[model samples]
Target: MLIHGHEVPGAIDEETRCSHYHKENDRIAIKFHCCGKYYPCYKCHVEFGCGKKEVWPKAKFDEKAILCGSCGNELSVNQYFQSGYECPNCKAEFNPGCGLHRELYFET
Candidate 1:
């Protein structure tokens, strides 16, 4: 997909996924994930490594994503960290229990 450079800023609600996806063997086969972003779209642990303040450092996030630090033990796409979207993840509010810590910040 050719994303116009001008369109980059207009992408208010867009997700960048593997252009080609298939399942082989016992693992969900996927092409080499091209580095782009890890913006958490939902409570599904989707995160963007944009280095935003919402991005959890390597050690903070964990495998067992139980309760998030912002939304408490809730399971909803809206509860997950997002970019630009008004963040509901607050201290002691929701806890995204996962191996990767989340922060709502962007590296400039």
Candidate 2:
């Protein structure tokens, strides 16, 4: 399926398949901890999926919460934050503006 102009591979397995979380220009995207799914942003999740948004516990910030769309590498929130939104393994550039919504999906 195509999401936000990106082709999604594999079958649509609700338990494991995440939505296309990257825009045409985005190199990476955030994954939803609530469902282990990825979306371009919180808006994308609300527009395409169901349920309340959930963030990883601050204590578990090191858990995987982002996806490197360029290389399919899953990154922990802490890693992404420290890298300034750059994918460590592939050096892909995620939209820096995403940080503005941190509080929406993260505990302060």
Candidate 3:
């Protein structure tokens, strides 16, 4: 699925929610560092992405790697971390549960 011109592989909705996670606030697509592809979640990436998975390196945190499904806002890793689980541009809430798997997408 494409949301705001960004391809979100394995997306189940326009909001970028996927089969593995479809909570109300689950509306973000992460750009995989491994393949430079966007996926709604790590599980989706595992299913439809390149076999190799790599967390976004801390050195590249300034790059825009997080896509806000609500307003199509492109956020850098550092901006997303400082956003408090919300879309800073649209003020939409993000699934805080995502923090549990932070290690999967970001260098920690």
Candidate 4:
């Protein structure tokens, strides 16, 4: 397990495997559970850690940073240039560079 940026030697319960990635040539091959076959297609080069479940570039984005309320954690305009306004944080999901943060509260 990772503790304070260090890994402790112990047993783990979770594991993950990608039907993609080439270790010999240092490349990743794409594999989807559809059509019963692994196929190659378009992919995004976003920073590692973003969730991607869609097709191609539409799959990757700053999903984690979207919830960051701290300044300098905002999305960049260049990313906006590629894909339009689509905030993944609060319901104010259409203002790419909005200066306002959402005040919505949920207790129900």
Candidate 5:
């Protein structure tokens, strides 16, 4: 799918194959602020990410910083939160447990 005129990769189809937090049908891939790369969740970042995690600047939360791995929609952190953690485009349900790791992507 096209996001901001660029290609955003699709979600990992085999959820169990990866150590991320996505459930069997979750389509949201977190655009980790530290590396500016998308992953299924913080655990995926921890296992596959590069270097140490860097906090997202408070000012960047409004940018299209999160990704809908299903349809390649780039949404802001606020939009993601407002979405009830679901993808607005494809209506894919996100893992509810994701809330436990909010600090990985956003500042408390």
Candidate 6:
């Protein structure tokens, strides 16, 4: 599904939530560094993305790699890291649990 003009291949709703991790605050899509495509989660990328997966390099942390589903705002990796698990643009909460999987999408 498309959310905020970005394709979240396994998204189950406009908020970017997917079957693997659907919660009230699960509302961000990640722009995978490997293929430059947005996916709702790592599992979604594994299932619907290009075969290769690569974490966003630390040097590229300034790149806009996170999409806030609430207001269609694209945030740089650094911005997202500093957002306190909320969308700075729209004040929408983000799943804090996602931090546990940080290494899956970013070079942590």
Model 2 agreement with the true structure over 1-108: per-residue lDDT tens digits: 443333333213322233543344355545666766666567666766456788777998988877666677777888888987677887767777678788877777
TM agreement with the true structure for every prediction: 0.16, 0.71, 0.98, 0.17, 0.74, 0.98
Q: By lDDT, highest first, what's the ranking?
A: 3, 6, 5, 2, 1, 4
Model 6 compared with the native: what TM-score? 0.98
The lDDT values for all models are: 0.24, 0.63, 0.95, 0.23, 0.65, 0.95
TM-score for candidate 5, please give it: 0.74
lDDT string for model 4 (1-108, tens) is 232222212212111112232122211112221211122112221212123333323233322122111111233323433324443333223332222211111011
What does candidate 6's lDDT look like per residue over 16-56, in tens digits? 99999999999999999999999999999999999887999
lDDT, candidate 1, 1-108, per-residue tens: 112121121112222122221111111111111222222332212332232234333443332222221232322232333312222343332222321322322111
Ten-residue region with minimum lDDT total, candidate 2 = 8-17
In candidate 3, what are the lDDT values of residues 22-107, reduced to their tens digit?
99999999999999989999999999999887899999999999999999999999999999999999999999999999999999
Candidate 2 collision pairs: none
Q: In candidate 4, which residue pairs clash? A: 21-28, 21-29, 22-27
Name the regions of candidate 3 deviating beyond 4 angstroms: none
The 10-residue segment of model 1 with minimum total lDDT is: 23-32
Which residue pairs does candidate 3 place in steric collision?
none
Error of 5 at 23 (Å): 2.1
Q: List the residue pairs that clash in candidate 6.
A: none
